[model samples]
Target: MFEVERHCGPTPRRLRETDLPDLVTLSTAAGWNQIEQDWLRLIRLVPEGCFGVELDGHIVATTTAICYGRDLAWIGMVLTHPAYRRRGLARALMEHALAWLDQQGVEWIGLDATEMGEPLYRSLGFEAEESIERWAAQAPGHIAGEVLPVGFEAELDEQAYGVSRRVLLEHLAAGGSYRIRNVGYALWRPGRLAYALGPCIARTPEAAERLIRACLACRPGENWFWDLLPANVAAVELARHYGFTPRRHLVRMWRPGRAMRPRPRFRNEWIYATAGFEYG
Candidate 1:
């Protein structure tokens, strides 16, 4: 068995641009799909809110907290190197990140908890909110229909996610955007292993399909990842229509702190595709 290097206990520190390589390596070792740029975005977006632990002079654990003002926030990217498993490093970083977000006075903190991490999250008081699934398929051969870009629906988005996600959505908007007037919007961005279609908010299946086709046309024949809430039958049907199959599952978990209980839940039925696991 490998052993921790002597006198090499690294405390929680702010993740920096310099830690990008180590971050990617740690996540890859865990069979995750995050890439270098993904980790860098988190670092630059909220360096102070990103925390990591080093072992043997390399980062082996990490956790990120993103705040949408004091009203809502999210904790994600909780990962640790395989060699360091069960040593409490991931737990420590989580506790640290949660404490930090708490200090920020964020009313609600949520995360998409993987099966392995659910028990720990339960101990920390994060109750199940809903089921999120990762669906995937090869890009459709032909664009199904005409889709229009009607610009961002910030007000609609606010109702969908319960908080304005314009900050995050704006950054990913460059990837691609599909929208329908008075209906919904969907975005497509490149991912480490495939293109991600998500944060999709649609009023109807037709609207969602319109947005989905626009994105698939942008990158034909490439792998696509769609994370959606199964509660919305339309979202699930749309995925199947596009040949997307359920690949992974996660529970949207939430913990309220320094605020009232029964935290306000987001409109999951409206979220056809998530921005990313790290994001939601």
Candidate 2:
């Protein structure tokens, strides 16, 4: 039987290898789903950021902090073993991780909250921004691949990389990180360009909604968005019970720094949990 132990900062155990099975157990126990791929992507892109809590040499809770630079960081993957709840382990691990980022001069820290975690984050100074809403339209019941929606582009083209680069550059230009996770892609023919990430219909609101519907159709359940600011009243209003809510709110508590411009208007229509908060 395992018993609790205190964390030793910056230890080798902090960056141990993790797998989906371990993450699945912890996440399901914690009532968090839909982020397994995000975690998997992070392990590939940046593994050193993943953290775990061990009791009697068994892993229990886990968290990760993705540091973008001296001023930007995102902390996520906060999970605790079901049997270990209410033991202060989650709080302790979070504080340690946030402190480490602070030490690194990460003035801006962000995270998305689960219902159970909202109070904890609120207690720790994470303010309510705006509630997030998810609006999804089921693909045409009888639609065939030959009839892919208009303006529905795939990321599997010669220009795909350049397009992706532009979107990420725009993201960073807006004070957001140039994260490769939120940029959705599709795996088409092995060598052929499969799918595209940024297929925006920036002119009409309905067109924007259709673009999102189109993207969701292309990947089915393979692609998603995370850490988008809740700034769109129309999107929020359209998202009730459609897989969007305050639960989707990308919460943050930073030490204060430079101001960012208002978020992109297009984000109001399409954004799902892609690679967890660490990537955003």
Candidate 3:
């Protein structure tokens, strides 16, 4: 295995496809669910947004920022090799991301922070917003019935996400996606360890359940990951009813720093599931 000194200065740079193997190693080491496609998609989505820090010419730490217009943005994929922890890598990478976002005129930023990472984010001016839960299960299922497709407007999605990111949906729905009669929609995709179902939004619990049931039936007995906000009781109930148990927890944080203006209106009660920690 490659080795490094006890301490190394983090040298920030843009990431490339050639770094795929290293990226996978970092996420796998942390027991994260990202695969090559997930990482590559981000690299392609925002060519200059994926940042990595190298030590002695070897990539050791990384962070990514995606601005969904000037109104809002998200920072994710903050990873550092275990051998290089506590050496100012994460902080440096975070600073780099924030500076870039500021240049893009992004007024609001957010992330799903693990308990281990929460304190660092808080130090950077991110405030707790809500609890994000990852629910999982493996079970066979059959569609309750078919619901005809309907027009899902960008404004409709912004109502739940608080930002318009219609372009992102095309990439996130690569595996398979389904939409119900204007009131609800759900998407499912392949992950490193399992299929992920999420970003589900609906006007009513019944609409949400129908969309969820449709996704569950798509892959019978396969492992699945479902991320949702606990503040939405209907979302919590749907996961439990569909046999998914809580697998992970994260604190959703918004950078309410002095740099930020008043926040947008976010309605999580209508958000049945979040897209992914990386994409959110």
Cα lDDT listed for each candidate: 0.82, 0.46, 0.82
TM-score rank, highest first?
1, 3, 2
What lDDT tens digits, residue by residue, belong to model 3 across residues 151-248? 34366688777788787776777767778755878888888888998778888999888888877877887899999999999999988987889999
Candidate 2: tens digits of C-alpha lDDT, residues 25-77: 67666655334544555565456667777765556787788765454566777
Candidate 2 — worst ten consecutive residues by lDDT sum?
186-195
Candidate 1 lDDT at 36 equals 83
CA lDDT, candidate 3, residue 57: 59
lDDT of 3: 0.82
lDDT of 1 at 197: 84
Candidate 1: tens digits of C-alpha lDDT, residues 6-104: 465347999999988899898888777677877877887788899998778898889999998777888889988878888778777888888888888
Cα-lDDT of candidate 2: 0.46
Q: lDDT of candidate 1?
A: 0.82
